[model samples]
Target: MEATEIIIKCILIVVIFAISLVVAMYSTYAERKIAAFFQDRVGPNRAGPFGMLQPLADGAKMFLKEEIIPANASGLLFIVGPSLAILTACIASAVIPWGQQLTIGSTVIDLQVTDINVGILYIFGVVSLGVYGIMIGGWASNNKYSLLGAIRAASQNISYEISMGLSIIALLLVTGTLSLREIAEQQHGFHWNVFYQPLGFLIFLVCAFAETNRTPFDLPECETELVGGYHTEYSSMKLGFYLFAEYINMFISSAVMATLYFGGYNFPFMDDLGLSQNWITIIGVVVLFAKIFAFIFFFMWIRWTIPRFRYDQLMNMGWKVLIPLAIANIVISGVVNNFLNNA
Candidate 1:
């Protein structure tokens, strides 16, 4: 590659990596503040005005805390576990389109790191790999409770992923493409796929919560049962990596949801603005991020609003309720497609 192209790609990758860490850091503060608001109590107010610097304080605490490994733990796997989790979490953003390309002088810059044709499948594969990190950590800890948490996490991720894939299949039927950027382009303005695949969207959203192990569905890490769950033996920044990965996943999931259903960086009436290409792309990027942050807030809101599901209940919902609905959506979508083709 030319030096300029190499430089640009390196810059994009670094910027994206930094953005993920920063957003994940702040998500903790947002979650605490939101939870406090709902619980009718004051949240963090120390470490900085109105707790704005709380995430930095938390990061510092993580770094300063003593790193500990259980005596019987497989030291290598324990360390590898959190590293793999955070690495996979960050890489998932590579296929995501932050905005349409920008034309600056003689060069055109793509807003995404890479545009693979099978981007959806790529995300699915990466998401599935995340469970290995949790399982390895739990098993390596040599703690029975941690092992149980790993079992729970493995089963939970496997079950939800099935439904998630099925829901995406329904969307694939509608969009006829696996490339996320292409999918976003197809949903130009308000003509988003959500209007056509509402059922699929709901299934995908629920599966997203389950896949992320977020609340109402966080059985693996349900404190009451599994103690601290998979990361029970972890400490210091090692533990922090696992926790931070969840927030990074949340941000990526939010961006994917917006791209798939909410028009990504596209908005209605944007064409009426008559802005230049560069300005329009920038505004689109802003709009896309706005949608992503809104969904991140929703993830936090649900955490504070809902109670955890019992294990049996979580399994039943995934298998009996969600999977069936997902299949039904596929069938319905197929029927509709047949009709449209015939007409």
Candidate 2:
């Protein structure tokens, strides 16, 4: 690669990384305010104008809080757990196509940092690695509750991931490519895969909730039972890292859902506007972010609305309901494709 190309890639990576962190930070503020709205109460209003700086204050508090490692804990692995969690969360964005190319004078730049052909698989692999962090943290803490939480997390992730992968198999049958960029490009002007793959999208959405350990599926961290779950023995920014990783995963999951089902950066009449490439690229980026924010809101909305599922209920839904549905959807998609091709 040319020196200029290398420089652009580095800049893109840094920018996307920074954006992920910012979105994750503000998601906490958004979650609190949204929850407050649902409960009919004032949210954080003390920090900045309408609590704009509440996340910053929270960050400072986490930093200033005393760091504690249990005497019985595996010190190094305990620290490594949250670090790995956040690291996987951040790196998963590398394969996501943020937008179409930008034209800056003579130079062209892709909004994504990298466009691996197996982007979908890459995301799945990274997400799978995230569970290890929880497992390790819980085990390293040397607490039974923590160990139980870790075990729950591992089992929950494994169960749901099977259905998640199967749902994507149906989508891959429709899109015919694993490259997220190609998938996004194929979805031009609202020809979204969700139109044809609605069942697959629904399955994927539910699995995303389970995978992210959101409400209705947050059994791994059932405070009532597990006493803060895997992080029960954690303190300070160590706890902060685990919390941050969750929000980051939520953000990335939102992005992936938007990209895969709703149309990544494509909008209706996007080509009809007679806009320049640069203008289209800018609008596409905005549209993608809008979709991501919508999904994030939906995530938070469901969190406040739904009660957490019992561990048994969670397992049954994953193994019996979602997996069967996913398999049926795949068969249906295959038949449809075969019919269309024959026609």
* Best-performing candidate as measured by TM-score: 2
Put down candidate 2 lDDT per residue, 55-120, tens digits, no spaces: 999999999999999999999999999998889889999999999999898999999988888999
lDDT of 1 by residue, 214-315 (tens): 998888788999899999999999999999999999998998999999999998988899899889899999999999999999999999988999899999
- Give the CA lDDT, 0 to 100, for residue 192 in model 2: 94
Candidate models: Cα lDDT each: 0.92, 0.95
- Count of residue pairs whose backbone atoms collide, per candidate: 0, 0
Of candidate 1, the 10-residue stretch with the lowest lDDT total is 1-10
Weakest 10 consecutive residues, lDDT, candidate 2? 211-220
Spell out the clash pairs found in candidate 2. none
Error of 2 at 185 (Å): 0.3
TM-score, every prediction: 0.98, 0.99
